[model samples]
Target: MSSAEVVLDLVRSRPPTLGEGRLLCIDGPAGSGKTTLASQVASAGGDAVVVHMDDLYEGWGGLAEVGAQLGTLLLPLAVGSSGSYRRWDWRLDGWAETVTIAPSSLLVLEGVGSGVSLFAALTTVLAWVEVPPELRLERGVARDGPGVAEHWAQWTHDEQAVFVRERTRERADVVLDGRVP
Candidate 1:
């Protein structure tokens, strides 16, 4: 079975942790394929809604404050209410339009800081994707362009701090290899 199928089965076997909804946090370093895995899971989940962490970030330096933003987006959902958050406009370098997420059977939060400890208890599944730093850097630059290499460098440093503090990989329900197709 595919990795996404495994995650779906795991979610099915567990009780709802986010009030009436199950939350799947696909988190890892930048360009580790967390988004790709999330897309697969969301497609297989039928009723799943995905919220990208990229949208929550304020800018290149937004990693440190992501938990606060996540709280705004997830706290209401934990009580079976609709949640909302303002998206960050990378080009404008400011807050953009507000996005609302209604309660659902499954919600996938995918990105670097999606597995924060603040919401661990409410998460039904936390999947960590892993890839070598060099490969990740290469993939990130390829996607975001060479101009953002410095941004990517700082991002890698910031994300590592969070991962180490949270022991994210150690606490993950599943660790996926981002090198796989």
Candidate 2:
């Protein structure tokens, strides 16, 4: 079975952990294919809704504050209510419009910091994607542009710190190879 199929099967086998919603957190370092995995899972699970962690971040240095932001977005959902969060406008360097997410069969939260311990109890599945540091950096810069390499450097450092403290990978239900197509 494809990875997405495996994840969807796992999710379908579990009872809802977030009220009536199944929470699937796809988390890993930048450019580690979390987004791709999320897309696949969301497509496989017809009732899935996805919230990208990139939208919650204030800026390149916003990683540290994401857990609180996640709380704001997830707390209401835990009670079967709609949840909302202000999206960070990267180009404008400010908070943009709020995005609301209603509880669903599967709610996929994808990107760095999406699987922090703070929400483990509410999460039905936590998937960690990983590739080597060199490849991750290469993919990140290629997508974000070479000009942002310095920012990527700092981001790598900050994300590593958060990952170490959270022990996120160790806590995941599945660890995926991001190098897979």
Candidate 3:
């Protein structure tokens, strides 16, 4: 089976760490398959709510800060309470809009800092997706286009610090080899 299918099966079998719904995190370096895998899991998860770290980051240097804010926004949701967070709009270069999380049976948070230690307690399963640096960069540039590509390296560097400090990959419940199929 494909990696995505494997992850879906895992999600299906694991119980939620919080209230009725499970909180899942799909985290990895830029260009890794986190987003894609999260998308697939969400599709299979039935009533899944997805929160992209891309929308959470303030900019290229916002990994740590954004990660700190995730829990405040999500913890309330654990008990089926409504919660909301303002999403960072890359184009407008500011906090563009608020994203409200309605209670769902499953929640998927995907991005570089999605699995940070601070939010560990809120997560039901933390997945670390990895691809070779070269392949990841190629895919990231291709998907985002040249404009965002210019900032990729800088973003990666910032992400590295959080990954190390939090030991995100080491603490993962599922580690996915996201190399090209």
> TM-score for every candidate vs. truth?
0.97, 0.97, 0.93
Q: List, residue by residue over 1-181, the lDDT tens digit for candidate 2.
A: 7778878888889999988989999989999998888999988798899999999988998999779788878999999998899999999999999898988888999999999999899999998999998999888888889988889879988999999999999999988898874
For model 3, the superposed segments whose C-alpha errors exceed 4 Å read none
By lDDT: ranked, best first: 1, 2, 3
- Which candidate would rank higher by TM-score, 2 or 3? 2
Candidate 3 residue pairs that clash: none
Alpha carbon lDDT of residue 99, candidate 2? Answer: 91
In candidate 1, list every pair of residues with a backbone clash.
Answer: none
What CA RMSD would you report for each candidate?
Answer: 1.0, 0.9, 1.5
Model 1: per-residue lDDT, tens digit, 6-72?
8899998999988799999999999999888899999999899999999998898888887978887
CA lDDT, every prediction? Answer: 0.91, 0.90, 0.81
Residue by residue across 1-181, what tens digits does model 3's lDDT show? 8776776677669787657777888988888888888778777778888889888888777886856668657878877787677888887888887888887888888888888787778788888999889998889888989887778878888889888888989999878888743
Off by over 4 Å in 2: none
Residue 66, candidate 3: how far off, in angstroms?
2.6
How far is 115's C-alpha from truth in model 1 (Å)? 0.7
Error of 2 at 69 (Å): 1.1
**Model 3 C-alpha RMSD to native:** 1.5
